[model samples]
Target: MPTFADPFQQHQAEQLLQPVLIRVVDNLRKAMEASNWIGTYEEHLLWPEGTTTAEQEQVRQIAAQLEDADPEAAQHLQEQLSHLPMPFPGYELRLSQGEHTQRIDVWNLCYQVCFTHYDPDTPAEVDPHLLDEVGDVDWLALDEKAQQLVQVAFEQLGEGRKD
Candidate 1:
């Protein structure tokens, strides 16, 4: 089994995953702004009466700020968000790794979204030598994991608008 030179490696991985989590939240906020509720029930649950214009505008403003700060990342985040089903308000993505365990938690204000675990001791499919050659973490692998988390979030939330 491969061992990280320092425990901080786990912290580094969490740092890498932060942007992905932020993007996920931004995407959900955008969806809410658009009145693109995941399902009829979700729609009703989130806004039992109806969404106020002020609420919609608030979400829009937050998105605008994020876009203005980094348009490229915003665009990429939008593209990824488009693929996901609608999410509830206040959704959160949490990730952490320990000596032998890696875990992800996706949830919203009201309930749990999805939970995943991985054994860090297990060898990955990618060649170990390649990692050494790069002298950098495999970000693509983390991105894929992030995408999977979003997919699982959507699935756990249930169906949304077809379009």
Candidate 2:
């Protein structure tokens, strides 16, 4: 397992955060689609360094205390808790919106998973260049999990699979 000390600082962080975020988003997407609800998916996540200086200082104090008392345990605790903020300010929400005049709220389930700390106001129009990047997203393709969900739903409905 890669730790923060490795050359993979950002990479490790993304590895953990991205999948978790994606799963949360996917659950929201599935729920919304199932209920025939529509909307953008918004995620409010914590950002490091977006905190106040006083809060950082408080964290540093706690870390120092732990380090002096028990260096080994302190290191482990610090590594695990490093991503967390001392005062824990709050999260910033990001919502997904469609192009043109169409805008949709995230699926109800998505909201459950994402759990916005605060309301997400309308976001600026997405960059057109982002669309080009869309094709590179392999996860967007229908996978076995999605196919299985559809299959089960159809079976439960007493309907045969469609050709």
Candidate 3:
């Protein structure tokens, strides 16, 4: 959301931000793919994002109480789960492709798409090189694109819109 000094810098920032955005989108897509979010069960709450042993146990505990809730429904049943300890505990996706490793929160990204008031500070967290080059980004536009990508992913996975 930063301004650029010139049109060229603006273009460069846009170019540089593309992969970061894709990575962020992929973080969500991959998390969805990493596990089966169906069936209202405790085991369903477990995902690849939480790697630590403590985190795994936390999910196990959260799963036990969700006798009638699903992992996918967490966004909807927040009030139900609020009193219980969090399952994500920090839904940080550790992306290690090639030489660099970065952590992103797919859970937060999903929320941010719906509630835009949250700080879009991820660009800076990934790398200042990206933050320095970024121009004012149309986050709503990017969020829409992310939604499209999620739809495509669901299609590829043969997931249906269940109410």
- In terms of TM-score, which candidate is strongest? 1
- Indicate the residue-level lDDT of 116 in model 2: 21
Query: For model 3, what is the C-alpha lDDT against the true structure?
Result: 0.46
lDDT of 2 by residue, 1-163 (tens): 1123344433433333343345544553564455433344334333354677766666667667786767687777677556657442233222222331223232322222222221233222211221224332233332333334433432343322223
Worst 10 residues of 3 by lDDT: 35-44
State the local distance difference test value for candidate 1: 0.39
lDDT of each: 0.39, 0.39, 0.46
Which is better, 1 or 3, measured by TM-score?
A: 1
Q: lDDT tens digits, residues 53-147, model 1?
A: 66555555555666666777777657654543332443233321222221223223111111123333542122222122444545464344444
Residue range 22-69, candidate 3, lDDT tens digits: 655664555455534331111124334435776556556555655566
Pairs of colliding residues, candidate 2: 28-110, 39-104, 39-105, 40-104
> Which runs in model 3 stand beyond 4 Å of their true positions?
1-89, 119-163
For each of the candidates, give the backbone clash count. Answer: 1, 4, 1
Worst 10 residues of 1 by lDDT: 109-118
The alpha-carbon lDDT assigned to residue 135 of candidate 2 equals 30
In model 1, the Cα lDDT at residue 144 comes to: 49
RMSD per model, one decimal:
16.9, 16.1, 14.9
